[model samples]
Target: MQIIIINGPNLNLLGKREPEVYGHQTFEDYFEQLKTTCSDVELHYFQSNHEGALIDKLHEVGFSYDGIVVNLAGYTHTSVALADAIAAIPAPVVEVHISNIHAREAFRHHTYTGAKCKGIISGLGLKGYEFAVKYLQEL
Candidate 1:
């Protein structure tokens, strides 16, 4: 099966940005481990700090990939455009959040993209990606 992981904004700073919330390991290291652990699956990753770029990527892979695991970060609350992109896609999308947004600021509690996703995995850290991939695999 084929799957894509798409992360938005500030997430590229994974290891260094906020160790307490996101953990000390960079996504690159974790991604390598994931690739090795799920060797039978073809996994691809893309991260962008730009909203339009993320939407473009979603549109690009939305139809062809078997599944998509997306972490839209702040866009989750603010971007109707991103949500629209998700709604337009054919591939099932699983929204992930390393930290529990509901427990954070009040504004973070709402997600514009969640309603469009097939599922959501929140506060599970990087493991959320693994769960999302497995869920898609099962489907």
Candidate 2:
């Protein structure tokens, strides 16, 4: 099966941004580990600092992928457009977060995209991505 991993704003700076919370792994490290763990599946990864680019990528890959694992990052709490795109996709979406938003800022507690996702994973650092990949493999 083919799965797409989508990351949004600030994720490209993962290892450097806030190593204390998001962990010390770079995006390449995370992707390589995910590839190793989900060897049976084809993983397509994408990240963008721009919201429109992310939305466009979602629309472009939506029908072709079997599933999508998204860490919408800051968009999760703010982007209704991203949520709508996720809702429009034919593939199952697993929303992930490095930190537990609910336990962080009050503003981070709400997600406009979670309701559109098939499942949500958070507070597990980079492991959250691995879990989402495994969840998609199971399906």
Candidate 3:
């Protein structure tokens, strides 16, 4: 199976941004472990701090990939265009959040993108990507 992980904004700073909530492990490290654990699957990862870049990537891979695991970070709550991009795609998308948005500030509690996803995984740290990949593998 083929799957792509699309992370947005500040996520490139996973290891250093906020160790308290996002954990100390870099996403690159975790992605390596994930690739090792799911060795049979072809996994690809893309991260962008720009909303339009993310949308373009979704448009690029959304048609041919088996599935997509996306964590739009702050854009999840604010970007209607990103949500529209997800909704416009053919691949199933699973939204992930390293920290529990519901447990954070009130503004973080709502999601414009998650509503367009196949399902969502939250408060599970980087492992949420694994779960999402596995879920898509089953489909």
Candidate 4:
């Protein structure tokens, strides 16, 4: 299976951003661990701070990839275009959030992309991406 992990805005600071909420491990470290565990599958990762770049990437792989694990991050509450991009894609998208949206501020409680996803995994840390890969592998 080919899975693409699409992370957005400020996520590049994963290790240093917020140790309490996002943990101390960088996403790259966790991604390597994921690759080790899911050796049978092909995993790809992309991260960008730009909204249009993300949409472009979604459009690029959305149809060809087997599955997509996207953490739209701050865009989750703001980008309808991203939601539409996911909706337009054939790949099953599973939204992931390292921090629980429900447990945070009211503004973070809403997600424009969740409805467009096949499922959502929240507050599961980097492991959420691993779970998403596994879920897609089953298909």
Give model 1's TM-score versus the native structure: 0.98
Worst 10 residues of 2 by lDDT: 28-37
Q: Candidate 4 lDDT, tens digit per residue, 19-118?
A: 9999999989989999999999999999999999999999999989999999999999999999999999999999999998999999999999999999
26-81, model 2: which lDDT tens digit per residue? Answer: 98887997798889999989999999999999999899899999999999999999
Superposed Cα deviation of residue 120, candidate 1 (Å): 0.7
lDDT of 3: 0.95
TM-score of every candidate relative to the true structure:
0.98, 0.97, 0.98, 0.98
For 98-139, candidate 1 gives per-residue lDDT tens digits of 998888999999999998999889998899989989998998
lDDT of 3 by residue, 1-139 (tens): 8899999999999899989999999999999999999998999999999999999999999999999999999999999999999999999999999999999999999999999999999999888899999999998
Clashes within 3 Å, all models in order:
0, 0, 0, 0
Q: Give the TM-score of candidate 3.
A: 0.98
Candidate 1: 10-residue stretch with minimal lDDT: 32-41
lDDT of 1 at 82: 97
Task: Tell me the spans in candidate 4 whose CA falls farther than 4 Å from its real position.
Answer: none
Q: Rank the candidates by lDDT, best first.
A: 3, 4, 1, 2
Which ranges in model 3 have alpha carbons more than 4 Å from their true place?
Answer: none
- Candidate 3 backbone collisions, by pair: none
